[model samples]
Target chain A: MATHLILRKILDTGFVSEPPPAADPALRTREQDLQEEILKVFGQALTVRHVDAGSCNGCELEIHALQGAHYNIEGIGVKFAASPRHADVLLVTGPVSRNLEVALKRTYEATPEPKWVVAVGECGCNGGLFGESYASCGRVANVIPVDVEVPGCPPTPVALLQGILAAVSR
Target chain B: MRIGDNEWPLEQRPGCTPVWRGRVPAERLPALAHDVRGCGGQLTALWGSDDRHLGGGFAIHVAFGIPQGTAWVSSDLGAEAPAYPDLSAVFPQADRMQRAAFDLLGIVASGAVDARRWLRHGAWPEDAWPLRRDFDAATRFEPTLDAYPFIQVEGDGVHEIPVGPIHAGTIEPGHFRFSVIGDRILKLEERLGYTHKGIEKRFEGMTAEEGARLAGRVSGDSHVAFAWACCMALESAAGSPPPARAQWLRALFLERERVANHLGDLGYLGNDVAFGIGFMQFWRLKEEWLRLNARLFGHRYLFDRVVPGGVACDLPAGAQAALTDQCDVVAMHVRQLKEIYDEHAGIQDRFVATGIVKPELAARLGLTGLAGRASGQAVDARVDAPCPPYDQVKVAIVTHDHGDVAARAEVRFGEVFESLRLIQELVRRMPAGPLLAELPTAAAGAEGLGRVEGWRGEVLVALRMGADGRLERVHAHDPSWQNWPVMEPGVLGNIVPDFPLINKSFNLSYSGQDL
Candidate 1:
């Protein structure tokens, strides 16, 4: 009965995933040939490690949305790794608060070479509403090198996928 | 004096609800807190404010959840020696709130048991109070390494496991120290404050309108709740209640936010147990739900939708039918999922009896929100103290006495249905009126408070108007503060591997509490 119900629900919500949105090639940060070489190594099997430096968790919610059925990002060979060492891309959100600055830096260093960092949300892009402060380190770039900055209070899931693609785009 | 017995005097503040606001002498701080708690009133929120510039010492404020309504109490202390009697003795949850206030405002809760720092994790110097009037918002000091001393448990076969300020997922940062033998956990101590961004200091001197935007972002998950509460305080102080249409729409949006969060949590809870189908179906439903939000409110999370005096957006023509349809779809899907979850022994085994927070422990530790309800403390702020639309809606409180993963799941399922019914009821009965109300310019020194039953729990925002009608002190409290501490107690005796499942069941907010 459980299996029957599960299968029934699956059929009821059939083919909900639509064609993925295209990322702007102009949003590319790495050099074309170098990016191509790196792409050859990673292919479509990209690994992501999300770091919430000091987010309100708004941007993190969008990122989670990207993993849902409508935007089945994992179907496209992108998997969220549990550790930075297994990750090829670091998807960071929020203005880097001073408390987590060292931790963020260490995570960036822990990722093996040829890593790309995608700064997410308005905070990660340019500190959002919480600009430089006594406790905030401002944007992600203030602490680490950022390859792509997706600016929105929290960019949509489609926009997040685009940001991730742009990090590796030539 | 028992508040439920009407012994203590509390004056009604201007605005919605029976929220009473008044100031008492420093000597009466502990007495008031004791009386409030004595009469079934739990401390809703506690924070201290710097008041030296106003020719008074630092002031401490505490909101209590009495049977009648929320009571916003304040105590003023002298600047020469700013110390209020410690509240930790009466209400243990005040330990962290007091520590955080001290970290930001230099106000001390004299003789509190745990005097350690709460929200200051080597971000700034000890003496540089961020919320003080003289402190510059942009002041930067060279960072120092924090050596936080975690309490130790020494016995034969006992070992320690340290978790995160950065975890293995798309979650917020907080440290967890576990002392256990093998897998069976003995004690779990959580050290959060890594996400503190000086939000209180950031709200200094902003126009009440601008403060609404900052409050909305205090915890993104509770934007509608936080923003509405902030605006409530603003509207309350300005002596302006929003139009009827605006209040109903706010209720509609608030319910929608509840459904959105519950959907995500339901999916994530399933995924934690490696139940792939649960993650797939629920999140898909959640995505469709969010698309509706974006279509109606122009933002997926409805950020900035709840502005001062009223909501920023109004439902377009024929939007009600679509909302009704979406609710039907979600309700249908959740019913199907719940049935499947009910019979699955493997999933049930992992969920049931895991991470138990007893009813006795829950009340003593001040467990709150959905998790609190699951633990058998049936204190829904909506039902307990109805303000405007909630008075009309008559929210049905869903609770479970088990206080385990399964029980929390039951509460989530029950709440989703209740919230759906609320959405339909809110729209079906929404009165016709202006969508926005112009807030009268508040006078300097005027104060107000707003309380909303957010999806997670009560979102209480209090503000005092500064000179030139700017907000002098704005404190936005998330239920996460009260709930996070309870999570530590919940994890006791659970195995190391079962930690993730147990933690997700509670699903407390790190960023919300850190601020």
Candidate 2:
């Protein structure tokens, strides 16, 4: 009975199969054209793999938001890969902690070449509040080569999308 | 009569809990701990201070929260004899705290079973104690990627599976070593501190105002809690309480924070259990709530909103009415989704009877806050020790006897509804006054304790103001400290694939615990 009720409620709510609104009109055209262009170039959708170096989990929260219905990153030609070997972009957050420095390096190496790194927070860009200490190695660039940097305590989901687009475009 | 046997003078501090200011002989410290344990006391926190500048020796402070009230037991350990009697025999959780104290401040707990460094992992030299007065903050040490010796389970069938310090998913760095035989986990040992950024050392010499900002960043998810607690500690130390209006606003912020996190967690739990539809609906609701937070407060995460003396911003004229309407709509949607979650048989199969932590085990492990409540430990700081607005408003403590993943999810669902109710009441009874109060400079050597019921659990901050109104020491203790260890037992007996589900059920903060 409860299952039937749930099905009825879901039916009442209706489907939201359409993609979210684009942040910019120019970007929308680029995204639409890039979908086929990316397929032609990469042979598949752009796959992103996220790595949390030592974030406060602030950036991680916003990153999770990107997958929500409001900003379905998959709706646009992007999917989050589970492994670094399968990923085209490495999204790293937090000030690189000393203990995590080697691990971050190893993760970067694991990803196949022609990969782009996007440092995705204030900490990721310039070590936000936790600057280079004995325990921290400052920013993501200090450890690995970063192609794009999204700057916010936690950059919004739209900014993250832009960062992904910027990386893939390059 | 605990200290009556020895004529130790107990003095009341202006802004702190009752304190036994005078030192106890190193030999007599264990006896006092035993006596406190006999009277059913729980060890809240254990920390060491480098008092060499004020005196010739370091001081070890252990705080005990009992049925009566909170009390601090301080004992002096001379420079030559830095070892103090370990309380691990009496209280099991003291094992890690003692190790942390030894690692940071060079205060040794002589009889503690585990002497391994808890927070230190070759980030600094073995001789360099960061919390010590002589340790310079600017000194940079060469990075040494030294291997940590995790306790290995050696057997013919016990093959180890080493998970990441850098995980594939968007999670903070923490290494999990699992010893398994055919998918059944024999043991799971966690190696955290990968996110330790020397926050305690960074807090030194900061003004009280600046320290509040640092506290908020201690764990971004519990930003409001940590900031409010830090502010409470500073204000208490200065003997100045914030205005009633500010107190109500703080409560408002806290409830909103609670609702946001619980909603987000419900969505995540659903996603983990393969209910993608539920995940979308719940996350959609959470996004709407967060958008409202951005409209009300400036930031999406509400960082730096809670400041010393009062909140940085106040609600606008029409904001309350709008928020009230939003809450009603959110509540209706939440009820609808929760029904779906409850009715789903597949979700129940994954959630129920999985990650079960018995009430007895939870109690023995010193579990606190929300996870504890789910497991029937039933300790909520807001209800137990009401502060300001909570004193005026009632909080319904939710508890479940079955300590499983389903129970934890149930607790989250219940808490979301309670928070919604609280928000409605708080917004309706909005107080009017100046948002910010002028805080007086705290006296040198003055210490204060701030305990707030954060969304996750109790967020505690201990602050001591140095001369010239600078921070002498500030230790922000997250409830994750107590909860993380218990997560090990919760995952036991469950298959390795269910690890993520169990892990998400507890959802302890790696950065919070590491800091």
| Regions more than 4 Å wrong, model 1 | A28-33, B1-6
**Residues B41-99, model 2: lDDT tens digits:** 56777888888899768888876655444556678889765989888887776877888
Give the interface RMSD of each candidate.
0.8, 1.5
How many pairs of residues collide in model 2?
0
Q: Which candidate is the best by TM-score?
A: 1
Q: Kindly list the per-residue Cα lDDT of model 2 for residues A1-170, writing each as its tens digit.
A: 66786677677767544454433322221223344455467853688999988888899999999988888889887888889999988999999888788888988999996677888889998998888887788899999988778888878888888877776652
Model 2 alpha-carbon miss at residue B383, Å: 0.9
For B206-300, candidate 1 gives per-residue lDDT tens digits of: 98778999999999999999999998889988999999888998888889999999989989989999898898888888888888889988988
Off by over 4 Å in 2: A14-40, B1-29
The numbered model that scores best in DockQ is: 1
TM per candidate:
0.98, 0.94
